[model samples]
Target: MPRMKVLLISLAFVAIIGSLGAALYFMMKDSGDKPKSSHMARALAFRVGFSILLFVCILVAWKLGYLRPTGIPLQG
Candidate 1:
């Protein structure tokens, strides 16, 4: 894989982790034993969006001939 693709994939992963951490932090920061549903929802949305973005990136890479399938060879 190229450097740009690697960088993007890593950044996406980091963003997803950050969102999750933020959600956890907000959930734990509340008093009165109430969870922050808004933060959790936003984090969830971010994660989903990032996942879709990653999927699109992969699809684009494949379409652009940057990715290829590798497996055992078949003989007939």
Candidate 2:
């Protein structure tokens, strides 16, 4: 369904953003030898916030009948 596609696309976008954020955080941390006491906290907060948002999106999509599971076979 179109709605399913939309949800999938949105999830993919969120994943990409999360990955980029994590990569940036790590790269910055690696390059800097200074103490990063707050770095881990910040990253954790971002991940938790974004994960909650993603969960809410999934719930909404499921409730609206936009995301039904398809038992399709996957190729190795």
Candidate 3:
């Protein structure tokens, strides 16, 4: 795997984890009876977007021949 691809994938994974952590934080910290849904929503949106981005990256890698399936053998 190329360094650039590895770096990008790792960063995307970190971003996704960060977004999830943020969402959990917002959910746990909002207890003042004020509307805190926005924060959580935003965090969730970020997580979803990052997940999609990661998926796209993987697809692109596969299409570009950077990624390939392994560890399975067909018993034809």
Candidate 4:
């Protein structure tokens, strides 16, 4: 496995977790009387975006020959 690819995947996982934590924080911190644009919602959106982006990145990297699946092969 490439070191850079590993690092990037690790970073993406961290980012996704961090975004989720932030959303939780905002959810608990907000007073519920806030405006329609909630910070918690924004954080959750960011988490979703990061997750999707990470998935796409992994796919692209695999297509570009940067990553390879190492799991057990399916029985055909």
Task: Estimate TM-scores for all models.
Answer: 0.73, 0.51, 0.78, 0.83
Highest TM-score scorer? 4
The numbered model that scores best in lDDT is: 3
**Model 1: colliding residue pairs:** none
Residue 60 in model 3: shift from native, Å? Answer: 1.6
Model 1 residue 2 lDDT? 74
Q: Indicate the worst ten consecutive residues by lDDT in candidate 4.
A: 28-37
**Which lDDT tens digits does candidate 2 get at residues 1-76?**
7877887768766775775587567656765554453565566566677777777877897899977877897999
Report the poorest 10 consecutive residues by lDDT, candidate 3.
30-39
In model 2, which regions exceed 4 Å deviation? Answer: 1-35, 72-76
lDDT string for model 1 (1-76, tens) is 4787778888989998898888777777756553577777788788889889888988988899987666788988
Tens-digit lDDT track of model 4 for 1-76: 4787788889999999998998878777746677424878898899999999999988998899878889999999
For model 3, how does the per-residue alpha-carbon lDDT over 1-76 read when each residue is reduced to its tens digit?
A: 4788778888888999999999999889948655667888999998998899789879988999888777688898
By summed lDDT, the worst window of 10 consecutive residues in model 2 runs over: 31-40
- Model 4, residue 73: distance off in Å is 3.9
lDDT of each candidate versus the true structure: 0.81, 0.70, 0.87, 0.85
All-Cα superposition RMSD per candidate: 2.7, 5.7, 2.0, 2.2
